[model samples]
Target: MRYLTGYSEAVRAQMQAIHARQGLGRLLLARYPAPHGMRTDRALHAFVTELKTEHLRRAPPIDKVLYDSKLQVVQHALGLHTAISRKQGARLKASREIRIASVFKDVPHDFLQMIVVHELAHLKERDHDRAFYQLCESMEPRYHQLELDLRLYLTHLEATGERLWSGSGSSGAHAGADPQPAAGGRL
Candidate 1:
């Protein structure tokens, strides 16, 4: 199970309750990619390096990166919609800290890269307006369709309770592992 580290115990308990009641644990586990035998540090670093490269290519420098292992639960997404500005594909440098969802640990490289592209776009455009989507489209073609597909994929995973990717079937699960801290970055 993924733990929401750093959050209040009460909030964490509340999250646990919500996830249990909704059967989110089973849903997420069933759909989440199984744990890979490789070291999370090595794999996550490689992935982030690629993401950072793409981020530097068209977007401004990212200040700090924060990812939640439990963010995949979807139920924990409450209140963030109001407190934090929602950007479909972009945000400005002046904008507040950004939060993103990884959904599954062993996600496809292309799909994960696509999401990084989406968040990087946010660093440029802070809304889902035409211009914002235009920028996203420029960064990633078929932006509209890709967004729809991604949402649909998540929805389908939820509906059918199927795993996204297969991995080593070790009992030690890493589907929701926290991001490892890098020199100037955190997983």
Candidate 2:
């Protein structure tokens, strides 16, 4: 979906033309190479390792992780809320399994890892509470800090209309994706 970034004049012009043609703005874009000095990537990898070793107890086999360049809704951390029902599973001859889905179209790696670790934790802890936070924290010591950072970044994007997280806005801004209050964000 062509996501827009208010970075360059060209980006805005393209967004304008696309918006003029189509009623809705574009959202997803292809995966561009990771930027130089992507310390975030290293941090994210460490976070994932922590999740595997400390929090999850056992590592859940990841089936597939696709980093789509095109997807709207900014960063919809989609995943199986719960395992498939027994009846449905029997119908599909599938095991009672849960899944995780995250969109990196425009999300930073650290933020993306936060969302992923959050979802993966759900596989172990069904409810969000002390146990959940404990698990999340065990994996990522600065769990709340990272979350706040991501929220601030999103607020910045909303205020300036510049794409947040990803330089290439493949997915357009997602609605209600940001739960944190945007105190200084746009009206």
- Where model 1 places Cα greater than 4 Å from the true spot, the runs are 1-59, 73-99, 167-187
- Candidate 2 lDDT, 1-187, residue by residue in tens: 1222322455346445544564221222122123223234344345445555665666554333333332234345333333443356447432333232333335555566666667667767877667876777777666665554444344344444555344554333543222332122220
Best by lDDT: 2
Q: CA lDDT of 29 in candidate 2?
A: 18
Write one digit per residue (lDDT tens) for candidate 1, span 7-73. Answer: 4456446545655576543444454344443235345445545665754466544444445454545
| Residue 48, model 2, lDDT | 45
lDDT of every predicted structure (CA atoms): 0.44, 0.45
All candidates: TM-score: 0.48, 0.50
User: Looking at candidate 1, what is the lDDT of residue 134?
Assistant: 65
User: Model 2 off-target regions past 4 Å?
Assistant: 1-60, 67-82, 85-103, 169-171, 175-187
Per-model RMSD to reference: 13.7, 10.8
